[model samples]
Structure formats: structure tokens, C-alpha cells
Target: MNTRNEYIYEFGDFCVDAVNHLLLRRGRPVPLKPKAFDTLLILVKNRGRVIEKDELMELLWADTFVEEANLSQNIYELRKALGESAREPYYIENVPKRGYRFVGEVKESVVAKHADKVEEDSDKTIKSLAVLPFKPLITEERDEFLEIGIADTLITGLSGIGQIIVRPISAIRKYADSSQDPLAAGREMKVDAVLEGSIQKSGDRLRVNVRLLSVRDESTIWADKFDENFTDIFTLQDSISEKVAAALSLKLTSEGRLRLTKRHTENAEVHQLFLKCRYYWHKWTPESWQKSIEYGSQAVSLDPTHAPSYSWMGASYCTLGIFGIVSPKKAFTKAKELVEKALSLDPTLSEAHEVLGAIKLFYEWDLASVADSLKRAIELNPSNATARDLYALYLTAIGQTDAAVSEVKQALEVDPLSLIINTDVGYILYFARRYRQAAEQLQKTLELDPYFAHARYALSFVYLQEELFDEAIEEINKAVTFSGRDAASSAELGYAYAVAGRSSEARKVLSELEKQSKHGYVDPYHIALVYIGLDDKNHAFKWLDKAYSERSREVIYLKANPVCDPLRSDPRYADLLRRVGLP
Candidate 1:
């Protein structure tokens, strides 16, 4: 019966992740409404035989009164979604005046559970936990960043303890409501316990109230209140983290103990500025990223020895470069310099190593050496989900699908609610050539946040691979709109147009990109994508060469990106891969 794990049904190129309620074909999602999918599932389950219409209707519409039209509509939608024609059906066969049956050969396989299963937290001796963002007690005098920043710091401290799985701030920040129940949030996060609190400020005095609640029993495991001088936030964070760890009965190593009390900057004001930088950084918008860099730069100026500030600033620069908000050459160069400075100042900083890994991967194309930096970052901070995600990306670029999927899955466990990590999962699956699974995963991400541009952009790739050009163009159009016509999304939209056989529209996009390039930096790799889509091999190679010369971040994925499939057989592609040193 396989009670512990669910199953995925594979037939031809289609996969049905039954537990996730996802249907994908050739790694691209086939969007069927609930009833349509249910209808398809029943047919697939009863394959090699036909079920009577009356019995099938009863199975599908149990305890509900539904007409024959409703059942017929579901079948119609299922066939449409699956691209199954009525006259010559490859999958679903309609039994004349009787019922329906799936004609394709089906293979059922159990979904492989991860070693560190998040869902079984209650049964584990070592607990999984989440620290919800501390609400502001005094609404009129609230410092939003400080309130959330306190919880972020606590999560960072507790993450060093190998005995506990502390959910990253990104996973729990959404539970910031003053009236939200900690137990409810804990249950939603699937953690054994939750640490939640409130922050209040009055002149030079700062006060915080916190409680650790057991999700299983809805009991307060520990509770406390602290009143300290505003400048003593470092001691406050240390006290809270240590007390929570003690309450959990975690056996922390000496290094974990030190990590609990570690301070990047002694200057409280500088720390505040750095927290502000982090606050904006997590917003994941170009303007917010710019604001993050501004705050980080201010922190650096205020306390030149604050290595975290430099690391975060470097991260912001790297993100901007990757997003094509600025020239990759300019952004990555500055990012590399800042990250190197951060490393020189504080060699143990995990974030610096993560940023350095990204710089090495995207800028230097130093695939051989990138693993060391990424691994070091994870070693220093196991809860560094971003580091794990980037490492997964590096693994994908080097053609290690299984390792990449595993690494990204671990990242998802740590920060399950992170939009970017969720998108990265789909993106990696896309590179793995599991288009259906990619589409399913990405569609679920969109369910989390419909307006997330990157998820849409990633889904477009899955659609392109499936030759669902209209859906691809539609998804990329939303991505372009959501991302404020960001060059990357805009470029992808052009590629979609070209691939869809809309040459005039694709050329129009190319012309627009050229004009935009005159005013601001545009990745040559983007132009190359459109050229490839248009089947202009010469033009594509020209732009790709430019991208190579500029060390554009997008070029690093040459080995894995399906858009570059057309170029792979070319000698120039092999030379590019050799020059970039990618295996």
C-alpha cells in the first residue's frame, strides 16, 4: 500500500505526481482543473480496461449531484489538456456509448523521500523549528526592520546547532501579524516548535517578549521577557538564542556556542544599517536591491570593519548583475572586490564565501574552484539555504542532475516558502529535462505567489521545451510585466516570440532591446537566446561570443540550457564550453 510515501504515474512522456496533484507532459505542465485531472487519474488507474460511465461518474462525483454534461466536460478538458484528439487518441480512448480508458502504457513509482524529511519532525528526537518574525509592540513607534531583524538573528544563531533544523527567516517572515497564533504558524510550517516574540522600544531602552511553543501540544515550552539598553542588542540576541537552545535541550558544540554570541559589528547603529540592508535585500526587487546596497554601503562607511556589510553589498551587486540591472562586468567586478575584502576581513563569514562562490561561478567561470567556496559556506552555516541553492545551480551547470535536485530539495526544506528557491527547483528540473515535473513544480510555486515574476519566467522554459508556444509566450509576457520589463524577462519574451514563429514580433523585441542597450547594460546572452530561437545560427553565435567575452552570467549555463541545444553540435559551442572550462 506504501502508506509512508505517495506515487507518481508515468505514461509515455507524461508524469502524474498524484500527491502533489500535478500533471506534466514531457516536463511541461498540462493545466487541467481539479475535475479534469481527477477524470484523467481515474482513467489512467483503470487502464487496459474500460469503466462503465455510471460507475466512473459515481467514483468522480461521489456525494454530489452532477449531470452527464459535467462528466463529459471534464473528459473534454482532460483530452484537451493532454493533447489527445478524439479521432486518433494516444492516451485516453473513449469507449463508444460506454466509458473511457487510458490506452498508454503506465508505470507507477513511489516518490523518493529525502533523508531529512521535514514532514516527520514530530517523530524526530532532534527537533525542527521556526522563529516567526517578532511583531512590533508599539505600533506608533515601531521599527519594522528591527522587529524582524531580531528573529532573523536568532534563526542565524540557532542554525549553527546541528541538533535542530531551524527554518530560515524567509520561511517564517510571512507570519509577522501581531494577532497571528504562534501554534498555528508552527503547525503550518510543519515544525516541532516555534519561537515567536514582540519588540518594543522606548528612548534608549529596548524590550522584547518571546515564547517558544510546542506545535504538537500547543504548550509553551519556554517564555521570557528582556529589557536592555538599545545598544546591547548583541547581548539580547545571544541571551534569547541560548535560552531557546537550552529549552530545546540541544547539545551545541563549542563553535555553535560562539556562533550564538558572534557580532559582525560592535557599533549598534552599523548593525541597524546592515539589518536594513538585509530587509531590503530579501524583498527581491531591483529597487529594493539598490536600496539594500545603499544601506550596506552606509554600514560599511560607518563601520569599515563590518565584513557582513561588504558581503551583503557584494551579494546585492551580484544579484543586480545576474538580473541584468547593471553590466555583469561592472557589477561582478565590484562584487568580487567587495566579497574579497569581506573575506580578508573575516575569513569565517559564510555569506562572504557564498557571494565568492557566485562570483566565481558567474564571473570567473571558475567551475573547478567554485565548489570549495560553496561547500565552505554551507560548512560554516548549514542553514544557509541560498548557499545550498547556488551550489545546486553549480551542480546543474556541470550536468549533475541528481546531486542538483538533492541540494535544491535540501534548500527547499530549510526555506520552504522562499519564492526564488521554489522557482530554482523548477528551473533545475527544467535543465534535467523533466519538463512535466518542472511545470508542475513551477505551477505550485505560482500558487504560492501568483505575482512572482521569476517563477513565471522559469515556467516559460518548460513550456518552450514542450512546444507549447502560446503558453510559453503568455507566461513570459506575465514575467515581463511583473519584472517591470527587466532585460532578462524581456529577452526571454523575444525568444518565445521567435520560437512561436512570430518573426516580426521577435525582431521588434530585438530592436527594442538594442535601443534599451544604448541607455543601460543588456546581457548579450539575452540577444543570443532570441537569435537561437529564430534559427539565425550566425547571429546567435555572434551574440554568444560577445556574451562569452563579457563573461555574462547567463553564459555559465551553456552546457545545461535547452535554448542552447541548437548550438551544442556546433564546434563553436564546444570551444565555448572548453574556454569556459565547464565539464
Candidate 2:
């Protein structure tokens, strides 16, 4: 028997048995997605040596055409499993425009416990799985979010089971539009099994059609159709999860099984509104956020006891604050109130905890409480990318730049296509003084989503830092073109022009901003940023003082804002920082 085939790598209170495909922390099994486990194996194999991004991608998808973003996502999950941070660098070092290097020291050990037999038996066991977004039986009535939601819910539910590793939703979302072979989708997601389904909605009735297949030979493992009224949607979701778990031969604790059976709301109207809110939530625009709030409110109105609706409502308010669509005080106050209501209804609601954490960090500036809240939220729902992303932001705010980077990386792991998370990572790199890396990240984001105005804005800022004034103006102009009369975009364009000695152009843009401000006051902090870009310290200080008086949301950027550097020597800057509860 080939007992020597069992290869194990040990590092820092953790061990990875490559032969058995097991990860252990403190000698106990640790749950991880299949791609993440593969990533770990690759990193540990090349420990202390930089692994180029292209090489890593090829190794992970030896026979697949997976997107580069998928590789990024896997690395994120691998870091989380190792309890490592991207910014802190205890385990992995990002080579900045190159690749990644595993910095953690490793010791190899050979375990001899029936290694040959275990290896043989593992061939028959399913090691990896992918849950493709369900198709809509009625094409015109396709509810993509609902279909994606079901797949996501199943992936998350199966992830908790220790038998097999499930691919993260981000890794599987690419297959949602895949009209190719199921085996192809499996390969893309790096999974051995593929779960695909279809949904049909007709007035008050619903039907869910599902199929599970083995990618190795393209064999069907399970197939079924769930027919029920709208009132049974939650039950339908649970039944699907249970069937998948059972098919996978995973044992579910009684409590865990019961949790899968519970329903949050019985009202059909509430459920419909919840679905609509989710649809708009993912759109992630100011207009969509407002619509989400309306839909979430309607959901709560239908059933006041629905905790998720309140949580979504709170999230909408947070979005408003994040996008600078409303006064921070108003947005934060509303978010806090709605989150508290959700908590009062169901303290275990993970979304509410996350929103509360964000409010604490961005509004109250309570670092300790913010950390605690995000930690609890992550514990409650490990699959939630938003929770992890916000936690990363909290880390950045508290000077834990490396950890923040890791958190955002993890977020990208769960939500690979998330424009917001990608932009945020660029912002973090910018703050860390990695201007070139920041530009690369932001540029990648722009490539993925050219309509992403904030990413273009970040790119312009990075170009400015690099002293590429023409390139900065070019990027800022693109931002203005896409943003369409956004005050911030206009201000940024004006700043770029002013910094490049195009004073006439700068004033022209500023005059447009002044005109817009006549209808609704533009953020004085934004004005200050532009003036600072123009090297007009007097004008910048004047606007900054106004921002202080108005309590602008951009005040949160004071700590790391390079545009505010000119103001740092002034005593008023210190006073402003103190007023904002920032050091």
C-alpha cells in the first residue's frame, strides 16, 4: 500500500492534509470551500515563493476557463480559513502587480493512518460541489435574484456540512448565464458536482424544478420538482436545502435541521416585497437604494414582525450614507433606529448586526463597539460578504490596514462581481500609500464595470498622486460623463483641471457645481477637496470650516485623505479631527 501518498503540511496551530483534503485548526476539522482548500494546497506547496496570478489561475483551473476574479475569490476564502489578513501579512504577501507568496512557515508530516485505503475511498466521495443559479421556467417572468437567492441559500446551507466543500456563490454566479454543459459550469467553479434548477412563478402559484449532477461523468444524482403556493416559499427553500444535504450524506444536528425548517414570514405580500427589496438591493445605486427602502418598508408594513425587512430598511439607510445621498446624521439616525427595531424583533438577525456595526463605525465612531458588532455578525453568518467587507472598513478606520485588506479580500471571495467591494479595496490600498497597486485595482474595477463612477473617481485620485495630471483629468472626465451631473463627480473634475493649471476649466466646472448647490447644498468637504487640489489653501480652509459646521459625511475621510494634507498644519484641522472623534 502507498501510505507515503498522504502529504500533510503544518503551520501555526493549523494543518492541511492534502491527500485527505482536510483542514484542521487546533486539531479539529475546519470548514472550507473546495476552491479555498485547493488554494491553500497551492500556497503551502509554494511557501515563501511568490506565485504569479496567472500561474495560480492556471493551477486552480487546469482544464477550465475560469475568470481571474474567481482566483481572487478563492484566495480570499483561503485567507479567512487560515485566520489571516491581507494587510497584516502573517500568512500571504501580495507581491503588488506580481502575485502572492505564502509567508507562513510550514512543516511537512506524513500521517500513516490507513492512508492508502483513505485515498482509494476518497475517489468515490464527492469532494467539491457547485450550485448554479436556477433558470426560470417561464423566460419572460424570470426572477434572477430569487433564483440566485435559492442557489445561494443552498450553497450556504450545504457549506455548514463537513462532508464536502461547496463553492462560494461568487464562484458560481458566473454560471448563472451559462447555457453550456453542466460539466463546463462545474469545471469553471472547480467542483465535482453541479446543482441546477429552474423556477416558475404564475400569479399566486410557484414551482421549483431542481437537478443535481456529477460533473466527473455528467450523471444525475437527484432530480425533483417542488409545487406550492406563494405562502410556501420559505418551506420550499428549506425542503430544497434538506434534500441536498441528505443527498450529500451529511448529518444535520436536530437544531440545525429545525432552523432550516423555520419560516420568517407567512404573509405572501411581505415575501413578495422582500424579494423586490433584494432585487433592488443588489443594483447598488442611489436610485435603487431609495427603491429598496420603499420596498423594504412595504414588506414591514405587510408584516410588522418581519425582522429581515427592517434589517433591509436599515441597510438602505446605510447605503444612502455610504453614497453621500443624504446627510450623515439623518441616514445614520434612521439606520440605527431601523436596525434596533430589527434587533428588538430578532436579536439573531445577522444583517441587523452588520448594519449596526457600520453605524457605529461610520457615524458614532465607536471603534470597540463597531468591532464587536461586526464580529458577532460574522459569527452569525459566515457567508455574508457585506458583514466581512464592513468589518474590513472598520479595521481600516482603526489603523489595521493589513487586516482591512484581508477582510475586503474575503468579501470579494464571497461576492466576486461586487463593484462596491472592489472599489473599497482600491481605496484601502490608496490609503496604505500603494498608489500604483491602488490604480491597478481600481482600473480592474473600471474594466469590469465601466459605469462605476466611484471607481473612476478613485482612479483619478490615484493618477493625481502619481503626478500624472493628464491621466487624472482623463479618468475624472470619464467619471463625469458616467455620473451625469453628480456634484461629487463635477467637483472631482474641477479639482483635476485646477491641479493641472487649467484654472479656467476648473472655474467653469466649479460654477456648474455652484449652480447645482443652489437647489441643494453640495457637500462643503467635497468643495474643500477640490480647492486643496487647486493649491488654494485659503479657499480649502474656508470650505472645510463650512463642512465642519454642516457636519458633512465626507468628514469620515479626514484621517487618510491626502487632499486634506494641506490643512493638517493648521490647528483647525486638529480641532476638526477631534470633533469627529478621529485621531
Point to the candidate with the largest lDDT. Answer: 1
lDDT of 2 by residue, 1-583 (tens): 5555557999999999886678988776676656678888999989989999999988887876545656675677677777777887678788989999888889997766575677666765776777888888777888777777777667656654435556656556656673656788776555778899988888878888889898877888888999887677777888888998788766566544754454568886677787677667766678888898999988888799988888888998987876667877788899999989999988877678999998887767776578678866765555567777888776666556665776688777655666778999998888767898999999898888798888998988888878899988888777778877553448887888887888887777777766766787577777777788777888887888787676675676787767677678988788878877775
Tens-place lDDT per residue, model 1, 1-583, is: 1236667999887999786577977765554545678888888878888988999989987886546755775776677667777887889888999988888999998866543453554354436889998888877777779888998888878886545678887787788777888888887777888888888888888999999888887788899999999999998998999999999887565666887777888899999999999888888788998999999999999899999889889999999988777888899999999999999998988889999999999889888879889877876777789998999899889887656886798888877878999999999999999899999999999999999988999999899899999999889878878767764437788898898899888888898887877777778888888899899999999989999998888888999988888888899899999888888
> Candidate 1: minimum summed lDDT over ten consecutive residues — where?
115-124
| Model 1 lDDT on a 0 to 1 scale | 0.84
Looking at model 1, residue 129 earns an lDDT score of: 89
Models 1 onward score TM values of 0.78, 0.75
TM-score of 2: 0.75
